[model samples]
Target: MENIVLRRVIPSDNSCLFNAVGYVMEHDKQKASELRQVIAAAVASDLEKYSEAFLGKPNEEYCAWILDSEKWGGAIELSILADYYSREIGAYDIQTTRCDLYGQVTPMEGAPEEFDQTIFPVLQDRTIGTVIEGCALKLVEEAQRKRSYTDTANFTLRCGVCQTGLKGQKEAVEHARATGHVNFQEYS
Candidate 1:
């Protein structure tokens, strides 16, 4: 089989999503700034399509916000990038094994062609892709058996902002809503 290997590492910064996507598509992390500019330009090119109601802010404001390197990106940014690249972008949640796909929708005429430049947890060329998949599943199963994943529903969390204790995800959200605190730490 062809040598399938894991993609390059992405820094776990606020701009990780941008960096990850750029690395997968272009094998470059410096593209984060350019990707942000791409998103801003996409929004600017279509104000009605990316309206205030659609984006939860004025187009100009949203464009400016996306250009800020400290800002975290979300669905709108992903969707714009997907359209710009004409490729289906998938974000996988490791703990949940959930994959969210962008650019899967049929595009209007004159849109760019669709292709896949993706990420993977590829095992080195020891055996095959199925073997790699099986290894991953086995690893996940072992982790589950060990209870290595955090139980967000029943775990103890502390609010980093106010030092308030929270019992679970619900409580954490409540604490954030009450005091505008967003950072939480999990502890036993």
Candidate 2:
């Protein structure tokens, strides 16, 4: 028999990613605030690694931006959290039907030190890619190419900051640049 993987649903708040990770690691769903703080501290402590060039914004700006409770977190936050907890994270993107993996591997149960230090990351990365490539992800991706997925280019969006309605990613980006209001919600 195969092990059934069950998902523990998290809230739909902006901090859902943090809450989900917290729940999985420590059985706590309300750790978003704390997790945000952790990411801020981690990024601040290592400006060299999390520089403006890498983060697409000033390090201080990113730190401050991420601390906002309404700001949504992404790969950067998950990578920081994974490092902080010393655990590999695999985030499932329901929209894409994909799992984005993060963090440093700590070796298998009985692996040699040399292999663990040098080859594990590469191996795991390839294995995950191979698995996804061999699975139904191809079908989902094909459907997406066939126009089965939502046209994010023209989806309805509303600025959560000022109750301003907008259309699609282009308007959303413009709104954020103009008003510095990054929080948004999709509307039908």
Candidate 3:
């Protein structure tokens, strides 16, 4: 197995999504404001293309709001950023084990070829983290491997009635009390 580990970049405040994008792009956190400005400008420059579905407001108003430092970036902003940078953006929810992809703009026939860059979003609560597709798969695999070992190693009790596993004596007793299943044996 590869010893690849994902690096985390915590946001200074509510601009976590923007900061994560900046980190993935090899930019300093301080540059997040600038990145936001760039995205806003791109949206402003092509109001018709963005439309209400993407911006969720009048093009001008959305542009202004997005440029504000206090504003949080969401799917709309991420989609715009993806197009502006010609990269794919992925958001991962670790607890739910889900990942959503954004920014799949079709290339303009005559435009320059887009780079295969991936941007990740780290959720505010730190319960979720995102990375490129390849890295994300690695993370999922590692998590599953660790989970299998943890499940087997930590479970100390088994209910004889249902053959259900329990983590400890307390859980075993509780299960028996709640389910009226008195028979249990500790697994060796």
Q: Per-prediction TM-score, please? A: 0.58, 0.66, 0.52
Query: Which of 1 and 2 is ahead in lDDT?
Result: 2
- Candidate 3 C-alpha error for residue 116, in Å: 17
lDDT of 2 at 162: 100
Model 1 C-alpha lDDT per residue in residues 44-138, reported as the tens digit of each score = 99988999999999999999989988677878888888888877676544566444631111123333323223433335763544554444455
lDDT of 3: 0.62
Tens-place lDDT digits, model 2, residues 1-188:
11112233467787988887776666677999999999999999999999999899999999998998877788999899888888777654445667574211223444432322211233645874354333334444554566553455798999999999999889999999999998888998
Cα displacement (Å) at residue 108, model 1:
38
Clashes of 2: 0
- Tens digits of per-residue lDDT for model 3 on 1-188? 12233434355465877877765565444666888888888888887797877667888888888877766677777786777677767765443446674221212323321322234345686443333355566665565555522232356878888999888656866887799996766676
Lowest summed lDDT window (length 10), candidate 2: 112-121
Write down the lDDT that model 1 would get: 0.68
Candidate 1 ranges with C-alpha deviation above 4 Å = 2-8, 101-188
> Model 3 misses residue 8 by how many Å?
0.8
- Model 2, residue 13: distance off in Å is 1.3
Best by lDDT: 2
